[model samples]
Target: MTLTTPEAPAGLPAPTTPGRGRGRSRRAGRADTRLPRARARRPLLFWPVTAAVTAFVLAFVAPFLVIVTNAFKTSADYRNNGPLSWPEEWNWDILADVWERVGFTQKLVNSVQISLGVVLIAVVLALFNAYALGIGRVRWRNAFLVFFLAVNVLPQEGMVYPVYYVFREVGLYDTKLGYTLLIGVVYSAFGTYLLTSVFAGFPRELLEAAALDGASRWTTLWRIVLPMSWPTLSVMCVFFFVWSWNEFLMPLVLLISGENQTVPLGLSVLQGQYSSDPTAMSAAALLGVVPMIAFFLVFQRTLTRGISAGAVK
Candidate 1:
């Protein structure tokens, strides 16, 4: 052991000179250098995006805050208090008054029935129309699409009188079926446009493959096209539902009887008849907002995905 002359401490190689080790380290560090300054600064790009997002959220949330706050307010509070002010306490009686005055349950049921009917008719017709426009070799395709686009651009005011006259002539005036049909026809053009784009983007190979396997056109559409197009369909349904539910002008023109009035019309009636009750009006408006909010919440993901897909491809 003593003669082991420090036999370079068992398995260890002789250590390099300090300068040499440092030189090697410097070279290795250079070789393993990270990305350039511009590349490294890429993460800073999100700053503007973050700012934009912050601004957007504030803008949208501000009005919603006002609506929700006013719903809890007394008439005096709404008139005298600041919009930004928070509620001092919960107010239950205001909601109760609104519910009774507006016949909230009956109006809500009518709205549901009308909106559901519109959606059913519009979506069914839209599905067929979209398939024809997108996949079928129907004549005057561009003209047809352009016609719908033109319809969308027209002021609703212009259609109202014409529609009123037509419904009057057909003895369909003051009927739920009339309003349903009117809203469906007016709104269906846009739905067809949306669905057409989605259907057009579908890979033709899937359709062809199904055809080769002896699948009829209807069968293929039922099994493949509709299933794959759910995101777009959901977006359309939610959109149409919101539109139909919120429609005030059409319902006003079409529905005359107390038994047939939709929620929006009924809310308007309450507002006029109960001008003395600010609490009631605010409450009725708040109640009216619930269905639209629920519709968005339920289908928001599908709407987002459908929009994203549409944008990308």
Candidate 2:
């Protein structure tokens, strides 16, 4: 005997399987749960972080705004309207006047020479010192490193008088080359310490492989280590350059001649015993900082990579 199964009601849809219904319900429920969580998280997490970062950036940029805006204003406008106010009239001539009257053109050349010299000398010395301490297996390396750290921590004021006397006796005082040497020696201590860490973290396997291939220590350092360490070296160069450029105390003491003065010294000449030109000084300052800003922009990526690489080990 054959039996017929019951059919669905006319005009009604066929029923879905239990598994299909369950899956649809589960998916719908999950979507419903996720949508609310995402909506809730938006206000609680993302917006606040964005606002904080924006505020921090604005705060950081506020000073540059003051410097740039006031740089174009006249001294009267600066004094009457205050530092934060917009300029009544732009005195674009102040920049040219600063360049000529303050002898900034000559001072800039002096600064470039001194700063480049310091960076060159410091980097070369630091590289040799770091390689000796880190890769050459030199005895008493820790003691040497400690001595450098000690020198780095010593106050510049403590050594200034003695340095002045010595430079004068050696007939090196008030000379740009003398100041360059002084800054190079002073900054090399920190550079040595920084590069030592980078070198010590060098891959042991590579050094061993180079040794196996009969590479001498100098060859390994020059070919293998230096090529790999260019980022850190570039960072050191930027640091030393910036420091030498901005250094006022050493330049003030070591360089006395108007012709030999750097940008900072030239800017000081803008001030008088009683009165000062705020607008021209601002222009000079803006000019003075441009090279540093340009340098950082050019090397920013390398600087970041160097810092991150050094931090890794």
Across 1-313, the per-residue lDDT of candidate 2 in tens digits comes to 9965557799987777669899999999999999998998889998889999999999988888788898999888988998889999888888888888988888989999999999999999999999998887699999999999999999989988999999989999999888888889878899899889878878999999999999998999889999999888988998998989999988899898989999888778888999987787788889988988898999899899988876775
Q: How accurate locally, in lDDT, is each candidate? A: 0.82, 0.89
What does the lDDT come to for candidate 1?
0.82
The numbered model that scores best in lDDT is: 2
**Per-model TM-score on C-alpha atoms:** 0.82, 0.88
| Candidate 1 structure quality by residue, lDDT tens digits, 94-156 | 888778877888889999998988888888888989999887748998899999899889988
lDDT of model 2, residue 28: 99
Off by over 4 Å in 2: 1-28, 311-313
